[model samples]
Target: MLIAKVYITLKKGILDPQGKAVKGALYSLGYEEVKEVRVGKYIELTFEDGDLSLLKDKVDEMCKKILTNPIIEDYTFEIVEG
Candidate 1:
């Protein structure tokens, strides 16, 4: 089997309202040292093993097509044996 660890996040310069809200809450809760927060998505996927190159390509296609938004979000992934 193969394991994929994917992370999706907003692109730089994009406003993250959720992150800002959480940061504000943290500051109000006495966590004054907290400067900023950026919320993102983490996905773990398992799949059957095939040709390594083909598998990598397919995962990339999945990321571009369904896993992340091309306009405002970016993603990175790592593949490892499971």
Candidate 2:
């Protein structure tokens, strides 16, 4: 079996509204030590076969097509054998 882990995040020039809101709320609650915050998505997928290359391609395609918006987000993934 294989496991695929994917991470999705906003692009460098894009603003993360949710993250900013959380940071602001933290500061309001007296958490002044928090400098910055960014929110992202994590996905885990399992495949029956231990094919590293094919699994990687499948995960990458899934991220590009469904997991993230190509214009505003960036993604990376890793595949491991189980």
Candidate 3:
């Protein structure tokens, strides 16, 4: 089987309100050294093994079409034996 591990995050220069909230919460909790926090998404998909190149293409397409917002987010994925 094949497994795809996808990570999606906001592109640089984009506002990250959720990350800001988390940072604020951490500060309130006295984790004062926390300089920055960025929130992201991790997704795992399991499927039958096939051509690695084709699968990678499909995963990239999926990320662009649905998993991430190309205009404001970026994604990277890795395929592994599962």
Q: Judged by TM-score, which candidate is best?
A: 3
Residue by residue across 1-82, what tens digits does model 2's lDDT show? 7888888899987899999999999999999999888899988888898667777777888998988999999998888776
Residue 34, candidate 2: C-alpha displacement in angstroms? 2.2
User: Which candidate has the top score in lDDT?
Assistant: 3
**Which 10 successive residues of model 2 have the least lDDT summed?**
50-59
- Which regions of candidate 3 are displaced past 4 Å? none
After TM-score superposition, the amount by which residue 37's alpha carbon in candidate 3 deviates from its true location, in angstroms, is: 0.7
* Candidate 1 segments whose C-alpha is farther than 4 A from its true place: none
Residue pairs in candidate 3 whose N, alpha carbon or C atoms collide under 3 angstroms = none
Tens digits of per-residue lDDT for model 1, 1-82: 9998999999988999999999999999999899789899999989997787888888899999999999999999999999
Pairs of colliding residues, candidate 2: none
Candidate 3 lDDT by residue in tens digits, 1-82: 9999999999988999999999999999999999988899999999897999999999999998999999999999999999
TM-score of each: 0.87, 0.83, 0.91
Consecutive 10-residue window with the lowest summed lDDT within model 3: 7-16
